[model samples]
Target: MTATPRPSESGLPIEPVYGPDALDGWDPDEKLGEPGSYPFTRGVYPSMYTGRPWTMRQYAGFGTAVESNARYKQLIANGTMGLSVAFDLPTQMGHDSDAPIAHGEVGKVGVAIDSIDDMRVLFDGIPLDQVSTSMTINAPGALLLLLYQLVGEEQGVPAEKLTGTIQNDVLKEYIARGTYIFPPKPSLRLIADIFKYCKAEIPKWNTISISGYHMAEAGASPAQEIAFTLADGIEYVRTAVAAGMDVDDFAPRLSFFFVARTTILEEVAKFRAARRIWARVMREEFGAENPKSLMLRFHTQTAGVQLTAQQPEVNLVRVAVQGLAAVLGGTQSLHTNSFDEAIALPTDKSARLALRTQQVLAYETDVTATVDPFAGSYVVEKMTDDVEAAALELMAKVEEMGGAVDAIERGFQKGEIERSAYRIAQETDSGERVVVGVNRYTIDVEEPYEPLRVDPAIEAQQAARLAELRADRDQAAVDAALAALKKAAEGADNVLHPMRDALKARATVGEVCNALREVWGTYVPTDAF
Candidate 1:
């Protein structure tokens, strides 16, 4: 009896073996250019990790700002190179802790940041000038960014000195994450405003990390991920350009975020293809002349959806593999998911272990010595070509549908991703795909594990803090600033300017967002089959 060969997560057939024949017509000069050059398939930088290892950025935040701040300090102490903040539902949705809708979920998944005071406490002892922070907040990204800037100025860190990224990719929110606030047109206006604001104010900051991580988490294949993400990137560039900004002015600051799955070879190829595609799009399509604008620098997070709760301890191995893939794929930075993530929010120890995973890969392994280790591998090169071709096909479809926003409106990306997710679920359920500990390995009894639990009292405490903030803050100033913000949103002015003033005047997140909501209104998705 012969054994059946398995397929990749993208449904690509896995051959028994691949050799030089696999890439018969492949040209190294054209397909695999020198690192840091145009069509950057091999890697983005010339030295890659040889100069310095990818920034070990760990994603963390839970409970109150003080608690989350403790975690950040611990991560920094444990040698994390950067901070990636995860905001709770209320904060992500632009709600204050005291809002009726924010009840019972003040700080369950991440820190609840209602006002500048919460942002202040979140980075209490951490110096804003020194640490690079990545905040995973959409819909109200500009609001959170202004709060960060406010906190930085309070700490005497100039705007130019503050370096970080905001996952301000709202298109993905509509397609997968479902945290969108306004309709597409208004949402895009806000994003364009962010680009204009950042180019002038925070030159060192990565204005937007156009993300495909959430789409992948929602079950997009590697090709689909790159295609949809790049399409969204195209939309953003167009929006900025149409708003009278040169492509090079803000394109250099654009970054990307993606998932690093356990499928090492394909994940590597996906990253390579993404860079190549983005490089061409920027240079050929948009006529961007800056080398930075052509480079597709991205941060990678190990796939959380791949982790299994059935045998949670096995997730450590899974994370190690995913982290390795991200490193080998030449990520600019990385965030390794904690092993216990499948069960609950990562405890302090688990978070440390996750950071240690990246440390081990960086310091303990020789993989960092070379740039593009698999540059000449026949299989990898072929996979890169295959993935790029497939992604381009998907991108062309999106183009025909009038780009990402139009395609999204027509339910193209969402429907495609849903089909992919359904296929994967079917494969897993039918045992056609073996998820080691999930489906194949049987366990009668599970080991004892004490997961970190958020305190229920956090809600009341946050509400009290908000009450005090409202009592002590200059209400007149907040009202005036918010009025200006609403006026800006209603007109052609960049809203971030007035939005910053509103935040500086101690306006709450909900108040600022509500002011804009009054002008731009909210999004109501139309059903599309």
Candidate 2:
């Protein structure tokens, strides 16, 4: 029998070669618009990277705030255009390092930031107005953002000048990641409050980064990734509009996050299809008039799940290829995962090399010399149409089930992604997937490598700091502020104002989250979903 044709990661069939008929009935006029125009399939901007390269952001954080701060300074010195922070479990989960629940986990995955004091140290010497930061925090995203603003005020930086993004996508947490704090109803309400607060207090801040990155890492194929992510984006827009806000007010500030895997062509098609779908949804469905409101501007990170730990150094090549795919796909910003990440936290040398990967893509490659380089290619155009059709079909299913939150309650997205993950696992086990260092190429005596390790003493030190903070601050003021925050959470008032007051009064991240938890309660997954 003839050899079977290989299939794409999304289970779509790939032809041996594509020609003119691949896009036989495609209409360029309606499908592909000029760059910076409607249906931004070409790109969201006219010049694209021809004017300036995409922002090179390095995601780094580990151990204490002081240690993580040093890494940030070093990255800036090494030519990083932006900073993306990674917080430890305790901070992301809204617990002080000293909490009984936080024991043995402080500073294990990322940096432990308990209060404004830690936030201040996290950006001590960095200029808030000059540098754009992206914090990877979900359920406790609001608290960390307020603390950052507090630090900016301490540094004399105006709120409007403070530019950054907070990964405030809690819906994904409920679906894939397990960091959700409140139930769906309360969580969406809190997100609406964030949109309102950012509009008034922090106009430059990205209110939420509706993410497909986590879902992809959890094994979602390209179609599932964008379908679920854009579905959530639509839900957020609907919630904001229902709360009496215009689409243009917050949509312009809205952004997205996605993963760029080694499959360059398909990833490029995915990005283009995503822009096209979002543009159509905003214009036709929502009647959004502003061009900015219709644009699907997103940041991309190289796929962390695709890296292999067997031959850790080989990951550098994987990251470089993945980063190239992101650039070719027209991402606004990018974070290149270091080669050592599959093993442990990136060593200083590996982190610099990761930044260098982007630098090479920018200065060394001619790929940035043009915009939408593969716009008219028959194969890419056909693949874009195919992915678009697949994603739209999934999106329609989500809509039929009453949108993202309802589908999520029914465990639709989660179950779909799990099936995809299982497929990949099975293929790997059968050796149908050729992972070079894993099954195909075997070497008996591999060289030893020492991975970077976080100091276990960090937990005790953070606990001591929390104790000292409690001793020095006025407990009554903090208590009253927390009580007010709880009252606001219990009522219809915007809670961030009181939450900010509590943070400004030296309230711990856990305390602020606890106040809301008392009112909204926490999210516990049920088997029925």
Candidate 3:
């Protein structure tokens, strides 16, 4: 007996099937090229994972500097190839741990790094020149970068030799995260200054990591996340070009950050589409001649939102699927979320298991031997094309309305994201979208999940150390460097150079932010925008 097929609201098959015909118009010569070639649709480098595998980097930082540093070393010993630091709310908000606004928040989510002294403790034994670091900071990126550079100096490693990434993507901060401190213009100025400083001084450092991870985490659909993120990237390039910097010089060092969701093939298609779209934007619209400018190298973190507090072990399977999607989609670096992530910060035991998942994939799976293994799949190709076309149409709408910055100011992107978010939430609520442990698979699963608990003693220790540093360092030198920093901010000068000087003189992150706050004031977002 022939069975009747169900239909979806979009008029597609309910259980949609795909075949070679799906890639009928997708040209091999035009779209799918060798790895490392122009457009970079396949992969970034020719060897791909054949020569060197993607870096296994798990995001781990919490509590005091010493605790985070210990965890870093532990992860390194466990074969973590790179370090990704997660700062506490106080650090992200540009406040000292002792500040009244910082109470109870210090060391709760991530490490509390208040000054250069804290920075020193954070990397006490780790060699600055050897290991690459990525700081997931945005609002206080300038101050953090300054401290990082000073750390390099103290370690006798010159700025030019330091290699790392600073999440200096401030635009998404306003739209999704709300971690922004300064107004848009002044924030852009700070980002530009970092771009300029790193271009001239720290050649190996990634000046900015334009991120869409938080956006997706905040409830954006995969399509809207990539589209809006690329829009912000284009706006940044335009702003940099207008700042009188050569496109090729700084563009290559620019990187991206993305989230790996559990939507297997859909996530893979989103990543592939993102690369092609970014390439076109850089070449066709921005007039970028360098192929490096067209390559969209990104770091991927498994979606934290997908983890469920109930049946947390199920999250391991989800993260594994998401991590596979990231690798197949060609991520340069990957961070697999821990199974216990939905409950609290991961314990050492849980973090190692998450890292081992990546290790097994890299070594045992043999997925790395081939580049773009699914490039010719009708399903993948068609989905990639569709996503690219949809994103481009949205981008054109943005262009007509003035550009990313203008659109952001008008809240167009924000409104669209919010709408999409609402749609997804409604779907989940109505049982149309299934979240296994949370919604579909009903069970009173009361497993005693182990969560890494940070003691309150961390804050007191950090505060005491901060006090000691203030008393020990030369107050006059700190005052003088801060004055210079304020003067530079008042002028057209790049603030990083003077800020680095202040960091080197033992000025705290709060002091440096306070000095700038006095000059540029602080950011306050209106409901309209």
* Candidate 2 colliding pairs: none
If the candidates were sorted by their TM-score against the true structure, best first, what order would they fall in?
A: 2, 1, 3
Provide the lowest-lDDT 10-residue window in model 2: 1-10
Q: After superposition, which runs of candidate 2 have C-alpha atoms over 4 Å from their true positions?
A: 1-4, 527-529
Q: Give one digit per residue, the lDDT tens place, for model 3 in 145-249.
A: 778878878889888888899998999987788888887788888888888988888889898999889888877777778888998898888888888888887
Q: What lDDT tens digits, residue by residue, belong to model 2 across residues 305-385?
A: 999888888999999999998998899999999998888888889988998899999999999999999999987898899
Per-model C-alpha lDDT, please? 0.91, 0.92, 0.84
Candidate 3 whole-model C-alpha lDDT, 0 to 1 = 0.84
Deviation in Å, model 2, residue 328 alpha carbon: 1.2
lDDT of 1 by residue, 358-454 (tens): 9899999999999989888887888888889889999999999999999999989999998999999998999987898778986988888899899
Best-first order by lDDT: 2, 1, 3
